[model samples]
Target: MTGDHAARPGMAAPRLALAGWVLFDWAAQPFFSLVQTFGYAPYFVRVMVGDPVAGQAYWGYGTAVAALLIAVLSPTLGAIVDQMGRRKLWIGATGAIYALCCVLLWFCRPGEPGAIVMALAAVCVAAVAIEIAVMVNNAMLPGLVDRSHVGRLSGLGAALGNVGGVVATLLVLTLFVANPGTGKTLLGIAPILGLDGAHQEGARAIGPFSALWFGCFILPLLLFTPDARPIRTGTPTIRAGLSALRASLRELPRHPALLRFLIANMIYTDGLVALFAMGGIFASSILGWTAIQVGLFGMLVTTAGIAGALAGGSLVDRIGARAVVLLTLGLLMAALAGTLSLGPDHVGPWAVAPPRPDRVLFDSAAERVYLAIGTLIGLCSGALLASTRIVLIGLAPPDRLTQFFGLFALSGRVTAFLGPLSVAVATQLMASQRAGIAVLMVFFAVGMALLATVKTR
Candidate 1:
């Protein structure tokens, strides 16, 4: 478990497995973007469920439930993986679970009894499984290359993921999402070989699409990724992992900087999650955008995310993690406040004529403005998250990665409820989704202030 263990002879093969690992994020994000956040969630509420309030509440519960499961299981599984020293096995198994759940989403037909419940369960299972996969993938980091390359490598993974998100969004927009006016896709074709707008089938197809995307892209990693040298057969890695967990928690006071970083990450990450998850919902409701508009917006953000992640990685290497995190967080605070301040018809608290939705992409001034702000937020989030991971790598004890990252995952999940819960509460109280959105800035502000005190070195 020494730092040298990560650099053992066979590790070279797994570093080439980076494509597969990065693709996992790419494959997974569309579900998060199109299905969970922008397209399906709102479509379910506004179109399928026929009640925005109910949809919002159900969505919040689903998210809360997913985070809860991840919180409970992330640490234990992380410890087990570390003890067993087979990160690839766990990654493969969890990837399958996530893909299957994504495929099952196609069955959640509109107006069906218990449809929302079923969909939420699929998402919850997928959420936990995906987190497990990420922890395993992350554990491979220190072993992949020299310490000098970790930040760049992490940034590259995130950037690849954004590219994948953009590609998926484009495909969905071309194949399924349509203009209500022309009833045509971005290609001006009839939604990929006659899949029409009838029955809202295009929207329904995203579930299976995401599943297939994940399944196909992960093959390279499974085939090419290297495995750790197996320990003696009689050793129970799971039991050892558990013991390690207890020891780590008792020992955390010795790593005060790591503890402080985790606390700050927990808060800011929650806020970031809340913002991205709800932005599409808010835009659709307030701006009266269709599925196509949402898709276009998503593509823009995805492109921005790629750029931001790469930039953040470079910045981390140059200025260090603390600078990158604080700078990005500051940008996040401004973006949140800016987004909340503007209405579809207004800019900077001034009201004007709302743009017509029927026009092409960026045709309306208001739409253009919204997309610009959305890109800014996306950029900062991408950079912040990628840089944060680098920071975690720097702070973790070399031998006990799973135990520490498990605690890291726990911090993310333990308070994940706060942001979504606040959104739900604010939506009801203020009679405006804007009020709920405005609540997110509180977490970012507090997280930044706390983060400033943590020492990376």
Candidate 2:
């Protein structure tokens, strides 16, 4: 893989490899979307674990474990990849770990003894492996095409992933989650393909479904993507790689811009991830959203995300990554304000007259306004994060792409525990979901201030 390939017109194999790489996201997002975001997390805390507050604590801790593990290993792996030049191998192995673990999610069930612990381990391990895979895959960016094309490819990949999420969410909503009160699926018929409603299998089945989706779609890049040329003399190669990794770690403080960008990203990205990871659970617990409602909301946000990613990617080239990111953060502040301001009835900051409590699903005008603000926030978040990838690619020194990207992933994931932990702590302290969400604004504001000084060019 080399940036030189961008000069050549119409390379079918590389295109296929790119598609295969993007498909990895398509394969992977279902776990994050359906299981973590929409269905399983809430199901785990509410039904499986039989407690919402304890569930939030457990969920936050599980994510913290993964983040800490990834933070420890990702940078070293990145440095080793740059030294050994075996990015593809690392990607393949880690991706396999992620896929298989996702499939194992099927075993988690309500009332199963030790199921929560086992599933949390699986989830954490899978999360760590997925981050490692991303570290390698993203390192491939500078080698895939010219600087001009990186944003577009990244955006396209994100858009495709969102599409995948939308499709998967819709399928699960239509097939698996039955409305307990109405006794009807989202599609207004019995769940398709004769899903057994007797055991509440719809929610459990997402694990295997995600596994299958990931496994089937991830093959092309393994076959078609070019692997880095191997270095000779195995023992010497390993020794040298270790030395190089050590050097990269030792050298980190010297690179101020890159270092600052990473630190800022670490803070903001953690908050972003925490918000999404816990959003559905909060809604289900507080707003009384069902699985069907969760699925529908996931689809809506995902659609907005895709649109934002495309727009952000293009805008990054014109307005610069710094501007795009700061703007996004500002929007996030407003969105959080709107979301938190809404009481049991009204929406958007404050209201002299709150709506009747009986109205639901953005039924009140204020609730509708809050949802609109939230949708905008989601859109900007998707775009800003996607653009951040391009910025990282541009800022990383040419020869150490993998090592730098590893640090990038590490920084993003390492502090991820803090946001959720804070949320968990705040939720417990206040006994309100809104208060927990309000805590995230501090992270966003501080990160934005730190990022404002970064030199994008």
Predicted model with the maximum lDDT: 1
196-277 per-residue lDDT for model 2 (tens digits): 5544567777777777787777677666665555554356766776787667667788788888889999999988988888
Q: Which residue pairs clash within candidate 1?
A: none
- Give the backbone clash total of model 2: 0
Collision pairs in model 2: none
**Model 1 per-residue lDDT tens digits across residues 1-457:** 1122345534343454656555666766777777777677666666666666666656766777777677777777777777677677778789889888878877888789988788878877887787778767877776666656765676677667777778888898888867656778778867764666655667777877887888787776666654555553234877887787788778778899898888899999889877877787777777777787888888887788777877888899899978899999999888888777777677776777777645556666566778888999878987887688778878888787656766776787777867777777777666667788888899999999998988766
> What TM-score fits each model?
0.88, 0.85
Best by TM-score: 1
Worst 10 residues of 1 by lDDT: 1-10
Q: Which stretches in model 2 have alpha-carbon errors above 4 Å?
A: 1-14, 83-89, 142-148, 192-199, 232-239, 249-252, 255-257, 314-319, 348-367, 389-406, 455-457
